[model samples]
Target: MTDRTVTVAEAGESAVLDVLSGEPADVGDDPVGNGDDAAVLGPAAATVVTTDMLVEGTHFRLDVTNWSDLGRRAVAQNVSDVLAMGADCTRILVALAVPGHTTMADIADLSEGIHGEAARSGALVVGGDLTRADVVVVGITAIGTLPYGHAPVRLDGARPGDRIGLTGLPGCSAAGLALLLDGRGDGPLQQAHRVPTTPIGSGAAARRAGATSLTDVSDGLLRDLAALARASGVAADLDGGALPVHPDLRQAAADLGATDIDARVLDWMLDGGEDHGLLGTFPPGVDVPPEFTIIGRVRAGEPGLVTLDGVPRIPGGWDSARGAN
Candidate 1:
């Protein structure tokens, strides 16, 4: 007898789907979730929906990460977007395009990751689609709900007298990616890239704390801030000394033997995307939430202009079309 590995092609769609659908969501003691044609979520306030896609070799590399990590990444990024909206995550929908050669074990690993992260965010996997494709493609749609009487946060609400706030360090994930590319893929920085931890519930916290505008730092701080500035018709001036720099990032720069450690670290802090931290603005004299650090201020100037230490800084963020972050 010979042992053989089973692939998605050999298992067929029904079996693959069965493997992908873990435990169905329990709605009022009645199970309602994936495996059905569509998901049925309970009633809620204003619903907020966001969808994102991750493609193999473009958004991630299989050589550096496993299917489970990819699954977690897909869910985490979308949930971050939901948090940016000042809403609470309720459910998630995943769509996957997998090559035939992929193994069933890999799909199981992916499912585990998806469900695990969803659980962490107080959400459930309600529905999704699985299909055959040339390469692995993961699509995540996160559903959230604004609390009763609270409005969704928008980028256009910032005012000239607002203070800019950030929830967490901005460059950890980017530094992790750099370390991975350098063939030194260990330590906190690398872990940050593998599965970036988002500041859960921070969006709602900011909203309740009188945040006038909000966004997730999925892109670089300068880029996302500029967008908020343009949307609100204001200019943003960042205090470079105020931005938090992770110790791991500084050490990574040293390990890589960069001539300009400060410059390299600053680049990651300014342009490194995927940290999934919350960035927003609060009105003057409002007590910013404890979770947020005041890093900049909104001011009267040219719209969409962002300055660092009183100097105009060009914004650079993730551009999938260009295949760079």
Candidate 2:
């Protein structure tokens, strides 16, 4: 009997790191390059590191998206994660894999996009590598530092009576994605699909306002809220009437035969992902910032349960592997 062996690609930076390091290992401190946005020495104030990947078809579509937009979206999403951790992003390291058929101009445009978005977040592209591949794949790793001795607001801290706050409106990205897939031409929906404007500074703002728990809305509100519930050992009940939906999305949903606007909006709000807004929990007496709206409350219950209008959550939104099917 012959044993099957898996051979990883050696062309791209991530692939090289995977092959050499194996299993995405992280070494906190190193005298040399350390593979982080910046070198680390001993323990300083606070440091946070996050990495994310965007595949060509899974995370984006090249047909309607420009190279620059793709680049910006990739970087913005990763930086959003860092901010969700209550840290300010300082630098990023990017790794790109391009197919042989890809042109230098395409690669340059992608670089320009990455730099452009990074600059907006007050972060710099310190180092990166590029190589040939069968398709385009972008990986970004961001590093940030928190204030001295300030503990990051993790998901586990949400108490039974905590008030839930959200930074911005939801469903625009999901609605936009639906529009693009439905063969709708370029418009606001397409624009949402192209570039996601994340709430960059709101994470720190939430932290300063005494947020007990914090997370970014990446994997739909329900899925991510479920995570927060599990982490905090509680139940999340969202006010159906309070969920804000974009007007254009409602019109678009109606055109697409989605009769119940609430369901459609809930699908986008609870199930839709990639809004990049901060969802956080605050103490009962704490005053949430003006930018945040009270959407719900956290209560003591079995871990990993989320309720919409007082019932178990149903799936009708985005899943990366499922591709909105």
Candidate 3:
């Protein structure tokens, strides 16, 4: 036997599909699972569908992130989308495009990452497609279900006197990216950049806590909040001092030689994307969930306006066309 690296081209399309499929358990007990032409999900009061695509050189760099982390990040981001709408993720469909020279080991790692994340989110990898491309592209579509009694949360639900809250730290991922770009060092922040984690059940919790409006911080906090405010026809005022800054993130700023540490940390918190934290508005007089910290309040003002500490601030975040932050 020859010890040779098996490339995707050598394995052919059939074998590539098999590797991506993982195991029959990956599909759970769906009526039609992996290897089938299509998937059949159970009935629900309503269905939620969201799609996200990550391109090779754009969304990620192959040298920095392994296939496993890339796979996990792809699924986690999409799952956060469905959860933001106050729905339970039940199934997902993946579509991959990779160059022929890609190694089979990389494909297997990618598949394992996808399956692991799906299981953690209580979702099934029912079906997907694999094909050849000049660059690697991973596209995933997540499906969520809302039960009869629960209503799907909307971006337009915020009103005057509502309280703004956040579930997780915002700047960790951005700090991680900054370190990676500067070739600083490895730590939790860098890992955060590689494999960002979402607050898995926070969306449903916010809904039960009477969240008037909800969104995930896939983009920067200010940008996502501004969009939500625009949809709700209200203005958001964030308390600059109240915004929780991660201790590690602060240390990262100092390590990077930031003259003004607070400013740099604030920049990451407001402008960093991909932390996958949940942001929502709760009606005044309602006790917000403990998982969330009250950071701001909603008031009547110019629609889509976002301010930090009573002063109007510009919204800055990741814009796909504009490139990485």
Candidate 4:
């Protein structure tokens, strides 16, 4: 195979930025270059900001994913937070800490991935800094804007009588992760683990449909939803049978040689993290979006109480200090 590695000096920070931001000479609405110290954003009724970091061996592994996919994942995760607020991401800042062994082509591919994701989300990459490290690290900060007369959706907004719904697949990433660990799954399963994509537009759709509260599944579904319930001081009861467990999860379990594949898949759906799917609570009588599936409903109970089929759901999830998987 041809060598694709390059030293920091060989790649040069400016060259990498050029690759990501487009030719330095071409000026867009907000030109991305080494000159600007900060990005000037449009005046909006409300602004929402969130940041996330991905470190080697923690959030990802170089052996399992490529630079381009990693870049996309780094952006996608931060965007998820913005989406949770029921706002649209307008811009992002990307910072990198790369080891000496990382290649120039690697950075180029990563930049391409970031640019592609930003375009898909209708966001721009404005600025960032490059630094040295023993391993690859990505830090992304996403800025979002809400329309006039709209407010950022908060976890505390959920109330009794609200309906709970979810957009897209929740357990695919976790199942993909299992496949990766088993080292016996196909490319798609491994791809989901490396760079899972969320339905970025679902947040706006939820807002339009009068969602009372919203959250993204960065952590396991139960864990994150439990936090939302705690913040709202209510209970979230989920129908165990209502979960939209992706078909791929069952296949992944079988591929991993699990005896009770159905039960294992259920476990992954409840406890798996990093799917980036959006979960929201809507006020009673409000119409949920077509993209969403009604999984359960909100009710009065002990604060932070989350149950699956009337039984208390076990608390197990992704911990930054401890691996989520």
**lDDT for position 220 in model 3:** 92
Which pairs clash in model 3? none
**What is candidate 1's local distance difference test score?**
0.87
Ranking by lDDT: 3, 1, 4, 2
State the lDDT of candidate 1 residue by residue for 1-325, as single tens digits.
1112588898888777776677755654224666677877666778999999999878888887888888888999999999999998888898999999988888888988898999889888887888999999999999999978889999899999899999989899889998898898678888788888888889999889889999998878888899999999999999999998897777899988989999999999999988999999999888888989999999999999999999999988786667454
- The global Cα lDDT (0 to 1) of model 3 is 0.88
Q: What TM-score, to 2 decimals, does candidate 3 have?
A: 0.96
Q: Which candidate is the best by lDDT?
A: 3
Error of 4 at 278 (Å): 0.4
Candidate 2 local distance difference test against the native: 0.76
What TM-score do all the candidates reach, one by one?
A: 0.96, 0.85, 0.96, 0.93
Point out where model 4 deviates above 4 Å.
1-5, 23-35
Quote the lDDT for 302 in model 3: 99
Error of 3 at 32 (Å): 1.1
Report, for every candidate in turn, its global Cα lDDT versus the true structure. 0.87, 0.76, 0.88, 0.82
